[model samples]
Target: MSEEKNEITLKNYQVKIQDGLLQHLAEFIKPLWQPKKIAVITDDNVGPLYVDKVEAQLIEMGHRVVILTVPAGETSKSWEQVQVLIDSLAQNNFVRSDGIVALGGGVVGDLAGFVASIYMRGISLIQIPTSLLAQVDSSVGGKTAIDLNAGKNMVGSFYQPNLVLIDPSTIQTLPKRMLVEGYGEIVKCAALVGGSFWEIVQKVHQPADIILQAESLIHASIAFKASVVMRDEKENGLRKLLNFGHTLGHALELIEDGQLMHGEAVAVGMAYITAAFEKKGMTAAGTTAEITARLAQVGLPLVANQLGSAAFYRAMLHDKKIKGDQIILVYIKKIGEPAFYPLKITELKKWFEPILNSQIEDN
Candidate 1:
């Protein structure tokens, strides 16, 4: 994708996904002005690979750097680990006025930014997202959270970043499976509000599509999210649409008990939701099949029999979208336009039987 095309205009945040974003890192950070000190928070998975480069870039620009490394992945997003990070900073005599730089995928970004949010009540957070998943979805939003065993992202905060530093060069090293996993959210964005971007998405799913063409997809997904987050930074309304496939998708993840990746479950979840929409006579006749087939083509299953829909529904009750105990789902009225529905538990239960069975068969 052309660097020019990756310039995304969010409601308030500026999300730049171009190739040379790092070339102007100094300029980007300049806006934040000088800080007493800066901490580069990363995870085990990412620290060894890109930490030196990121840290060196900052130091060369005359910033005091402290590197904090956490164990990689989701576990890092826990209150326990967060406390450890806080204690570490305190022990190191870091001040509240200092800023933090998060340089990894979603887990690192979420955990680090979250620490910055509560540390001394609030501080600056700079997101230098390396993974495609973070660049396209989690990195920019002030929405930060840690996972709970009962539910993913059960505890968190919404603290916007002071600056977002994206470098497509970092995405080149992403594993193929992880890369494919990241696309689930992008597809969710497309299904909900992609507009003409969906045409490109459909092509990308083809087995013949080249992986190197990811910049185009990444930019489109970011643009989609940028629009939503801008309208509803607090997630009161419009931003909920981005959860189109996430309701059931998240439930499936809980049901599997960390067995399925976020994106994989979302793939199945989107299929199930589209199916329900078709059953309600709300969707185009072929939409369900087309959606399922596309997910399948991309190696994401339409059905996951790992856990029954009954178990899944139980998990749904705990979702943030649930009103008390009822499911107020984020569903698509049509592509590019989203609707939030207050669905009765009983009403949703009706569709689970078939969706559950279908998921089993797919698995």
Candidate 2:
């Protein structure tokens, strides 16, 4: 991809999403023919579900396909799994010019993408997002990583894909909880680009059409992300804005020991952070109620609990976003307006005390 006059002809890859996207993988991916071999990395869950269909089409198109399946879910996105994939690629004589297609949700995309990045120094990555969250969020940005014992995404890279294939119909296979889990990313965009768009999230009849009418909302979230990524592909800058709900979110997950999904904790974290955003007058009146209703509609959380407050704060302090004990929290003033909040490390222990008080009810 070359940047000519601030216009980068996104040659690296393409985002071709239409109805019935999965079966048409061969058709939509014509530009991806440069690779000598194609490795489709998926997980145990998504492979049996969609692989045969996609592979049949790829074979018909005369492409040599390599299939690599990792255990499904977050735990699979680790150094060990990545090592297995890398070893497989090596055994298969994979080359730098070869491209890897990531199939599944964010976990698959991240794990495979990191492999694509580190293997042979750098390799091309193609994204086929089977989940709504991956389609709209994770798959687009080059940000790819795995969790560390220290914190989430503590080990990763900014490896963009050569192409992003989105099949909205895939959502049909997504469990209700998975479908609902995606809304938190949507809501993160909602809170980041606060305005009447948040109202649409509150009032839209068809959730499917919300992003269409509100493309800017998605773009806003990405813009916020791009600002961070553009400056720090390594996550060294404005990218912290994307962690709006992740402070308490990561901790809640740690406490649950990954019993809940990433977005689940984020949902709870968003609800918890609302107290701080509200206290600061960043959140509009009544908006909290509206988000609560919306979250419930999609099956997200609207509060955090006291049981894991200590561990959650501990995780936050050790978080990758922390800088010398100063926790930088992303706070929303309204929909579409997000700002950074740098809190002292010493105050973090005291910070959650008032925020987690029973005064603020959880949904």
* Number of residue pairs clashing in candidate 2, backbone atoms closer than 3 angstroms, sequence gap of 3 or more or interchain: 8
Model 1, runs deviating above 4 Å: 1-4, 9-13, 20-24, 206-210, 307-309, 358-363
Name the lDDT value of residue 209 in candidate 1.
Answer: 57
Question: Can you write out model 1's per-residue Cα lDDT over 124-164, one digit (the tens) per residue?
Answer: 78888888778878886688889888888998899888767
Q: Residues 221-319, candidate 2, lDDT per residue (tens digit)?
A: 344444445555556666677787888787777667877777777887777676766765767765455555667665576665543356666666667
For model 1, the run of ten residues with the poorest summed lDDT: 354-363
Q: How many backbone clashes can be found in candidate 1? A: 0
How many pairs collide in each candidate, listed in order? 0, 8
Every model's TM-score: 0.92, 0.87
Error of 1 at 202 (Å): 1.9
- The C-alpha RMSD in Å for every predicted model, in order, reads 2.8, 3.7
